[model samples]
Target: MREALCQMIERLVREEPGNRFPGEGGPYFTEPLIGFAAADDPLFTQYQTVIGPFHLTPTELAQHETPPWQPATVICWALPISEETRRSNRTETIYPSRAWALTRQHGEAFNSALRRQVVQFLVDAGYQAFAPQLHPAWREYPDSPVGIASSWSERHAAYAAGLGTFSLNDALITPRGIAHRLGSVVTDLAIEPSARPWRDHRSNCLWYREGSCGACIGRCPVGALSKEGHDKAICRGYVYGAVPEAVGAEYGVTSTGCGLCQTKVPCEGRIPAGKVSPLAVKPPEGESPSP
Candidate 1:
């Protein structure tokens, strides 16, 4: 079943025009591996441990098979490449204007179609289909005991799934090494998870994996990411004050977030060869604010 599912994912990726890597990337690639999940997998515990304060909605009790039912099935890891992925080309134009440009370029129509195809494939094969729930990371309120929206860090998931580990800049390092946008999907149907987690490989990149790259720490105009790590308070202060306009300029809109670490990290040079397509970002004056 796992092998078949993996094959199906590869097929969907290859055929979906929208799935094409940014440029005319020849083909979408998949690792020669799959991950399995048991209800009791230690990975879940590890996920919580690594992420610190976050929550997972109760998937077990939330199952309602009635209409409008959208139960999650598989935990998928997705990497979306943005302008930050390419450092060799440092022109401001190199970065994508939007965070979800890769997914949005295909249009909702194509994304829906592709999702349906994959979901149907899973269901027909007797596996329940599911979608990823973005775990809580940044919210306006303090952390709560109840399951919050945020899950473990995307980087942590990749690392736990054995895709890669955390860099000093706090990015996950995959063989591709570049920080493509990443997401996951959790489902009800059980399957064998990957035996060799990304942690085993470890990132060879000096910036993220090796903890050497601190460019982002200094580049943060507001000092959100500092020598000690992310200073949420300092960052938020700017978001709510005089720098609000500048924040919007950097990130696209006036939101209380930043990506200084993500953009200036080491993996910028390690974009995967699998991604051959050219990404498009809006032309900007110099640098944009972080999200």
Candidate 2:
């Protein structure tokens, strides 16, 4: 069942037409990395406290099925941004490149479709399944006391599934790197859980691990990152505020989010194994930062 499911995901991404970028830039996401966790993992409950008391566990959400079915597994995937798109965004100073913005828009529509497709696949296989992020009861709390948070966090699910760890900039540092989209599904399929390889949530992060390589801090155009870590509200305000009004409006970008910190940094393409990459930020000469 696990092998078949992984093949299904691989084929879906390989054959899905919706995975491409606008204007002939090719695929929006490379092949995704899949992982799984037991639905009853204790970490799910832990998220409720860390994210909020209202967060739902996979078993909790699965119980809402008509028969109050309990899920046995949580399947997760990381859709790494394509090399072309990441390269386009790497040189960006103020606005995300057109490729990046449109991908954030249309590419996410593809991600939503992928979620629906995964759910459908599990259902067709005679199992109960649903994407937590797509559930009607799912909710977001941009103004939460913890700063921008949600009732269910995909990043957290990815972490539990052993796909990645949290970074100082508050992004997941997956094996495929930080510039990626994450999604998950809860299902009755009884698949064995993947291994959690790290010692803790911040293990993959360069800053938190060795106390060096803070390149991502300077990559934030808005200074939303620092040694103290990310200011989620400030980051949110800029991505949801100035970005849309600026490049998104004039440059034909769809709704936009700035991920400059995710590119041209040490952890951009891979985990920095005990040493920072030479790709750490250094702007082109005389280029002024966005205001």
Tens-digit per-residue lDDT, 92-156, candidate 2: 98889988898898888889999999999888989889999998778887677688777788888
lDDT of 1 by residue, 1-291 (tens): 666767776566557666554566532222222333443444555444444434232243134333324333344454434343243223232223333332333423343454466556777877666443322222322343322225434444444454544444445555555445454445556665554322122333344233455666665566566555556556556535544454345544444233444454555535322222111133222211111
lDDT of 1 at 56: 38
Give the TM-score of each candidate. 0.58, 0.92
Candidate 2's error at 281, in angstroms?
32
Q: Which residue window of length 10 is worst by lDDT in model 2? A: 282-291
Give candidate 1 misplaced runs (Cα > 4 Å): 20-39, 49-54, 57-74, 80-89, 93-117, 134-154, 188-190, 196-211, 232-260, 269-291
lDDT of 2 at 64: 68
